[model samples]
Target: MNAGAVGSDDPGPLVLGPMLRYIGETDATVWVETSRPGVVTVHVDGREWAAPTFAVKGHHYALVVVDALEPGGAWDYAVHIDGALVWPEPDSAFPPPRIATMDRERPTRLLFGSCRTTVPHDREGHRTNGVDALRTLALALARGEEEWPDLVAFLGDQVYADDTSQAMREFIAARRDIDKPPGEEIKDYEEYAHLYQLAWGDEANRWLLSTVPSCMIFDDHDIRDDWNTSWTWHEEINRTSWWHERLMGGLSSYWVYQHIGNLSPSQLADDEIYARVLEAASGASGADRVEGSELDLTEAVFDLARRTDRHPEVYRWSYRRDLGDSRLVVVDSRAARVLEPQHRSMLDPDEMRWLDEQLSGDVEHLLIGTSLPFLLPPGLHDLEAIDEALAMGKHGRIAAQGAEKARQSIDLEHWAAFNDGFVEVFEMVMQVARGERGRAPSSVVFLSGDVHNSYVAEVVDAKARHGASSRIVQAVCSPIRNPMPRMVRVMMSSFARGLVRPMRFVAEHSKHVPEPAYPWAVTDGPWFDNCLAELTVQGRDLSIVWRGGEIRDGDDAHPVLTTVASVRLPGPSGQPPGALGWASGSSAGSVS
Candidate 1:
């Protein structure tokens, strides 16, 4: 258990929680938040830093940037929060301890996922218990039971202030007016603040965040469902005074919660507010002392992120990483969208230009972190397209809205709905896949999670699985916590299998996904129930493995879920698996 997060008696054993991400670049910047104010440090290999964290809106968070790192080298880290030392759980799905960095030197392994609601375990009524994917991985490292991943990319829905749990609801009641039905969502800063606490303050997850150098991109739930998709959407939302406060609170808290740690020294040097944040953190009071409460500073910061795009080169949320031979482009899909009707785009012109530039295959492997999958399951994509097209006309509008509500009822908001924006991102990725605009890297992969299930799908070109014109495969690890209703599982898969392609074909407004000749297909199997996917890139070969928890046949009446699937990628360099599913790394690296 992490020392700081748990009170005495220790709250059982403080297990790690969702979004256990690792993001490594030439300069490794590990970002996370804690339950209370104290020093959070990462001991990389051997060296350590008393990373600075700030308090805002009742939560404590930090982005510990470890600079001067060598690419392709592996290093282990231990997390220290306040005075207590904490590590990952033994069965943690996240490979812990040491990670091999990527660059020109070694292979890059990226494990990513998202869309986790902070719900109590079915029996525990607390954050722990059940098969916690991240905790399993974290504990693996703590016990030296698994391989450390080079990086972990977290896509979307980090905090769901809107779809809060009962514990969260009670916490909200202690603070403010939950009397009104701002209907099904969170309303103000007070609510937003406590929601974040419930989301990240869990003991186990806090330890994971403190150690792994993580990268993140936000999605709708970070603020609310269907945020900033279109002008109509925004208008419909703004109809309530509660909506404005919610947006203000959500976005404001995000500045402190997720975005603060993503900045580099160079980036912060140029960013006014971040620069202020760095300066203040370097001093005694930090942001904590700068204002009456961290919330005051956070409120202003969120407004800055909201307005940064209108004033480019100042507040860009998109980031780039040079991790050995691999390059990671972490984009801010939510804030950067051009949702206005006049010119709707997945990313605004400037942000799009930045992402477009990073799509080249310059590195050994290219990883694009867009909260929403650039390509959704074929059936679901088509369904969303059908609904979108229907929404354009008179009767279509009613039908589309109703269908959208249905999709919402089942939690299906991905690239398919906003066909225009979806196509733009698809084109960008395909262009990279084709290496038309520039040098195409050995592998171009999209790491995403928002869907409640986990699976790996390799994109194969119509003619060849591994060739100049091969299709792209998508690997998804979702609901690091099982948030889907059991009944909806089969239905979600059926929809994905049935409707995606046709919808994508019709929704090809931006010219990315080729019609009839679209260049990617799914090759891996899908597995839901709190799982993660690990991809290892050694030279030109990429091996992807999907890992989850399992339940033993005997032992106790209730079988504990343990590692279930280990779908190995077809590569000479992929690891050799032992009987029960643990795989040993092959020489996938160009390094000695």
Candidate 2:
């Protein structure tokens, strides 16, 4: 192959990332968006891999899989478009492209967070709650101080396609009629593309994304708030005139942008929708530059997305990865839901079976990343279960209607609401912990967000048959930038403190619920701070730290990381820490 010529003055390709994705022992994927078509190349320590860029509805993207790297190897890399250097922006202070492949012996340190809104990170941004923890960490890495996490798992709500920011509204107003159908929120593929650009476009975060491998799962906000919360909710949304257009746009954009990067080359080969794109690209093969339509792969992808939305059983969005001695299972708690009125489930039967299989495996540590918390506070759990039960006609039809109304009003949809699905996954987790299927892992950790408050909770399995060996923990960090309203915060604090006993009592006597096999409570926090959570897993010990962004001396755009709370857990050989009872709840004040 001829080495592409480099020109110092030529404009480079890359509008967004050299974002790392799915780094394996032998290969890794780098995703990028470029202005004008050309061959997009990622160079690792002088070794180069290139892929032709393709267009979808006018936006250009390329996914270059850098293969044949040694395990545990680290390499500083660069990006070029049609032979012109692009990345490590001119006089850039941020670090350049560098990747460290997965190594079995190394401890997996990961940073996870969700629910960040797109807004300028200035003084106004800070005062209004846009002090981004992810951006702060990026700057710290840029300054050559902190080491990078092996991966950053964005749990959900990466972009609020349903909620419009002021900047986004301005853009919409300038280009189209804000008074039109679909209004201020995103309308179609063009708007969704722009929303992603807003979310990941900022330079500091962009650089962080370029270097650290990222995995994402979408929540309701990626399409619309309360998406598929219930069968009734789905029907209600379907009635809207623009809902079809919105769904098509959101899912298609998610496919091209977020979902593709989550899969490995091997996994991508199995994806029919993505497979067609590669086929299209290879058919009209180009070495360097190519016209947009030569490889456009939108229509086919959009058609599949529509079918998947309507008939979810046809496709599976959840995926699992084995990172050496540990395993990461990212669940699809949103789109793969079973939304039948009488049999609502967090996941469809097939998806649940898949999760059950993925749950059991021999590993030192098992991490389950879900957009919604698998285990909420006992009070919240019971409340959601009650709502779901009532909606299912545990009471009369009139009462069921009232329950459905309440469910929609309060957003009462989570794993707890779908008791059967929750119990199934929970049982599988416990079975694995007890070594029923394999050697019990040291810990089974659920890393989740979406509550807008951060906390740590440990399962209190009163029914353990042989003194449960594995430590089951729920760690949540939320709203890397967005802050809850004061009223909502107060309400959440009250829910955390005063309702567990009453709700549990209701569950005990209610005909709807079979008494829970295990109960849990908030042991560390109900801290309402816009923050991120990090976990370090090595051998039999697991430690978690929550960090919030703290702006100093009015430097809102450059907030520093401050520890909110932390805890450590030992292996199954040791006794797990005793749960601090519900009375120990610290909801009176925010942690930060």
The local lDDT score (0 to 100) that residue 49 gets in candidate 2 is 92
State the lDDT of candidate 1 residue by residue for 1-592, as single tens digits: 3433422334322222222333444555555555555566767777886655565565556656566777656676666766466555444444455434445555666677787667653445322423556655665555566776666667888778677777777666666667775654677666666666576665445555655556777788888877766556667777866776677677666665566556665775676666655666566354336443232255556667456534533567778766676777888777766655334566667777777787776566777777776666655656555554554432446765775565555544456656566677767766776667666665566778877766655554322433343235566777776545545667666666766655665657523323423544554445556755677875766666655443344222222324435544432223221111134322111011
lDDT of 2 by residue, 1-592 (tens): 0111111133245666778988888889999877666788888887899887777777788998889999999999888888888876767766667888999888888889899998888887777765788888888888877867888999999999878888788777877888987889999998887788788878788889989999999999999998998888888899989999999999999888889899999888789876755765576454422354446667767887889998887888788877887889999999999888777789888888888889885789889999999889888888889888889988889988998898888888989888888888888888877778788888888999998988888877522643556778888988788889778888888876787889889989997876767666677777777777788885788877777767778777677777766767666655544443222222122543
| Residue clash pairs of candidate 2 | none
Kindly report which residue stretches of model 1 are placed more than 4 angstroms away from their true locations once superposed.
1-3, 6-27, 30-65, 69-104, 121-130, 181-185, 281-296, 305-314, 341-343, 394-413, 458-471, 498-519, 551-592
Stretches of candidate 2 above 4 Å error? 1-12, 280-293, 461-467, 577-589
My TM-score estimates for the predictions, one after another, are 0.77, 0.94
List lDDT for all candidates, in order.
Answer: 0.59, 0.81
Q: Give me candidate 1's TM-score against the actual structure.
A: 0.77
Q: Quick one: how many clashes does candidate 1 have? A: 49
lDDT (Cα, 0-100) at 293 in candidate 1: 26
